[model samples]
Target: MEYVASLAFAKEKDQQDPLNKFREHFYFPQRNGKDAIYLCGNSLGLQPKNVKAAIEQELTDWQQCAVEGYWAAKNPWLYYQQYCSKPLGAILGASQQELTVMNTLTVNLHLMMLSFYRPNKQRFKVLMEAGAFPSDQYAVETQVKFHGFDPESAIIEVSPRPGEHLIRLEDILEIITKESDSLALVLFGGINYYTGQFFDIPAITAAAHKAGAYAGFDLAHVAGNIPVELHNWEVDFAVWCSYKYLNGGPGAVGGAFVHEKHASNRDFVRLGGWWGNEESARFKMEKGFVPKKEAEGWQQSTAQVFNMVSLKASLELFEAAGIGALRSKSEGVTNYLEFLLQQLNGINFQIITPKNCNERGAQLSLLFLDKGKEIHQRMTDAGIIVDWREPGVIRVSPAPLYNSYQDVFHFYEIIANIASNA
Candidate 1:
């Protein structure tokens, strides 16, 4: 598709979009009696309108059924999270038994590390991208320290070479091969949050397996933004939160994936709780832990019904508009944004995100030579919602689910004006 020249052209494209009606299903935040041009789904998605009904159903059930609501409500609060599995599995490309919704993002990461990061005397090292999220870095460091290993000595942080914006795939493969004897696990983000770089997950998984190491991913930024095939990729484990692209709510519950290959491995150590016990035997209050036979075995508490109701509503939307279709549209929207950015010649702005479509999702991380934060503030004052990262990067994500081409064109128009004045 050619770059759109005006806001009217963008509106024409929106009119032709098959998923255009979905925009109405969400609760878009407004400023000055007008809908804000929201382009920050990479940070937090807009709330779905159906979420209220879902929450109300549970509230009504609770009032009428009381204690029986656990097993007797309209949707059965006892098994509320089960409703999430099938749709979530379809989104992540895993079987129902391999995925479950529970816990927060960092908590799930710690749980998976307990089961997957089995460091020993010889192979006592972990490998991860150098610039992973702060929460992930803390989790990994704490896990390393828990195992009596110093973070400086046991963690291998792989970073890009000098003056490069992204890590090279070949360089990562080389590290995996060279450290095969000592590496215990390979953990990485499916999409880097700052630069919006989408890593080669399948290739990285295969490389880790070849080196006799476990492979895992933090899909916080990639879950609803990109297409993933965790089961086909044979990833050992993975975790993600729902607030960003899933639009559940702020600090919403997260999900986890444990490949079926490890499902029956009773010897795999895990941090357990009563909720993880097999449902058939759970009420018996048995002395010993008899865990469930699937990924649900990782659960440590009762389902958070309200938060999960929000997620169920959002997942239904994802099910209606398949992730593959969304990703195809995302590529076009992001590429169009890039095309518009490139037109501002001699404007002292640079795109730090990877140029190749396969290397990114919907976000474009723009670096300004001067006054980056000021430009971001100007866009916000104009009722445009973009995010500013420290040290001079601003991220604009035109979400395929709700953002329109007109929104992008208007943003570029404002940006061009800002540049002219600067």
Candidate 2:
């Protein structure tokens, strides 16, 4: 596990990487006619090499079949979304019955809350971290307001200790216990986008249950970045975007999860469409809505065949590499990034991400006290494609599927030189 700060060391590791060939599977952004060191997979992933072909195939289908593509296309438009279940379910640790590809991340969260966040006079509050992604914070706030409660009274934000970067697990458990009587739901991000804290979902879910609340997650930064057992953890619901670690192209179709325990609850309130109705009676053009037997019942519209084409291409890489093997490689890449980062001289930045391997994914969020934006700009000019968060944080994520150890070393070199110059 000893890591060295040299190109040779990185090259050696890259040579040994089983996932090295995957780097070729993606088309990285070009910088001076070479691949840029793209560490922003946490934001938007590099496009898969096959994405064009995948999209073209769908375009061809649409052209050739006209209105008949609904059933005549290679992957029938009638049930096109079903194509994702096997590959993606494996990563989610879910049965295909529990998960379904549908709307974007926030849209699915809104839909899930409609069913799960059933608050009463006695229990109407939602509990979550203080700094959840802004969209999630807004969603919970508006949902509470729509139910005729003030957000100030209905939302409880559990905060970190004044000097600490991460929220304590004990603090979360204690708050859930204290607010048990008033908590209608407990929603949290699977990983905080800024700090990259991978939450203890199983523990949090169990605690939420004990506190008599439904537990759910917005897995924008965690899904596909790490292996999560939404089914085994008994997560009531979860949602994720496909463009980040899943390596789907920008604005890709996202997905949702609902536990099997909710499978038979046909009477629950849902905003439905004909696509969600059972397939047998769908074409009958009946007046009443008869929903499907599983999570697919939550679909509000027909599958967006074009939107999912790129996602299907990306999942093929995951299926080929396997999640377990990818996670192992990801740990190595991030740890090496950390090791090399610490070796830089005169750098005044703190890595806010959890140091414990189990508490993080591939991202390392650096809060810089010196030359923050300048350093970020310099890194960008040097062809290191990382992202800078508001205030003074830079997020670096070496995605195992496409990023190589040599890419990590080059990024380190750029930063080290910048620090030394400063």
Best by TM-score: 2
Q: C-alpha displacement of 322 in model 1, angstroms? A: 1.2
lDDT of 2 by residue, 1-422 (tens): 88999999999999999999999899889997888989999999989999899889889999999879999988888888888866889899999988889889999999999999988899999999989999999999999998999899999998899999899999999999999999999999999999999999999999999999999999989878999999999999999999999977788899999898885577767778888898899989989888887889899888998889888999999999999999999999999999999898888999999999999999999999878999999999999999999888999999999999999999998898888888
Give all TM-scores, in the order shown: 0.98, 0.99
In candidate 2, where is summed lDDT lowest over 10 consecutive residues? 263-272
After superposing candidate 1 on the true structure, give the runs of residues whose Cα lies further than 4 Å from its correct spot: none
> lDDT for each of the candidates?
0.90, 0.92
lDDT of the structure predicted as candidate 1:
0.90
Candidate 1 colliding pairs, count: 0
lDDT of 1 by residue, 36-125 (tens): 989999899999999999999999999999989998999988888889888888779999989889989999999999999989999989
